[model samples]
Target: MDDTANDDLDVAAFTTAIEDFNRFYIRLPTLEKLPFTTLSVLDTLAYGDGPMRLTDLARTEQITQPGVTQLVTRLEREGLVERRPDPGDGRVVLVHITEAGRRICRSRHADRTGHLIPLVARLAPEERQAIAEALPALTRLAELGRDRGRAAR
Candidate 1:
């Protein structure tokens, strides 16, 4: 195959790999408390990198601000997060996961991975290590694509 075609195949393969893995991720019973969409947003906010504006949260999720607001409102009621006036700009509030939020995130992530671990454990040890190593590369690949998307604008 030509180089370009091979590269396209690589992309397709990687996409398929992740989609397959995430299918397992989405199927975990730990997802019961929150839908995947809501869990995803919570995970993003829990990064502790810094507070993100509503618009930024929307952008991160590739969703609309109104959508993010509705999500935050729900999370807040669940005692998973709180909205606070932005330190940078009071008029623009940012979502901060509360202690409960942090606990839920930690617990849920653990539970989700617990579900995944048994499946991964079924693979041979070498295969498991290889999969573990590949995870970082896959994440970096995703970030690289996301960066390219921003630069394209």
Candidate 2:
């Protein structure tokens, strides 16, 4: 095969592998009853440097403003998040993740990692080493996709 053909095949295989891995990962049991969207929102807040505006959250999550408002309301009710007047801008409200939210995020991460540990342990040493070496590239790929998504929005 020509170089172009070889490259195309490699890209196709890589994409399929990623998709299959995602499908398998999603099937793993989760500790929380919260929907994926809710967990995602909580994770964003928990991992962010600080609180964020509703509009910013909406943009970041690629959801309608009204949808984010509703989601925030539910999260607030559950004591996972709180709204505070922005210190710099009194007119704006910032959404902050509570300790409870952070705890849940930590627990969920641990739960998923726990599930993956045994699966990963089953891999051959060389296979595990390959995955370890690929981490940086995988992370960069994720970052590129996320950046592209934001730019497209």
Candidate 3:
């Protein structure tokens, strides 16, 4: 195939693989333990620096400000999150994950790893090696997407 043809094929394959992964990843039985939305917010908070402003959380989750407030309220009531005054601005309150939230997030991560480890272990050595090698690129792809989101905002 010509260089252009090969490039087109590569793009098609990459896009399809990403689409399939996105569609199938959340459907894993281990991940279904909590409502996806709840887990999503928790995971976001877990990965963020300290407390996050409510507005920032809404933007990050692609939800309305009020919607995020409701979600945060629910999480807070569940003892998964807490509201704190942003030290820099008393008017600006930030949402932070509680210790319970950290524990839950860690448990969920471990569950996910446990689920995937056996599956990966079953793969051929070369296939497993390929996935291991792809990890850094996949992480970079995620970072690029996040950077694009910040730029858009």
Model number with the top TM-score: 3
Global CA lDDT computed for model 3 = 0.84
Off by over 4 Å in 3: 1-9
Residue pair clashes in candidate 2: none
Query: Comparing candidate 2 with candidate 3, which one achieves the higher lDDT?
Result: 2
Give one digit per residue, the lDDT tens place, for model 2 in 1-153: 333566535776787999999898866787876787898899888875469889888988878999999999999999999999999999999999999999999988888899999999999999999999999989998788767755654
Q: Report the alpha-carbon TM-score of model 2 versus the true structure.
A: 0.82
Instruction: Pick the lDDT winner.
Output: 2
State each candidate's clash count: 0, 0, 0
Greater TM-score among 1 and 3 belongs to: 3
- lDDT for each of the candidates? 0.77, 0.86, 0.84
Q: Give the TM-score of candidate 3.
A: 0.86
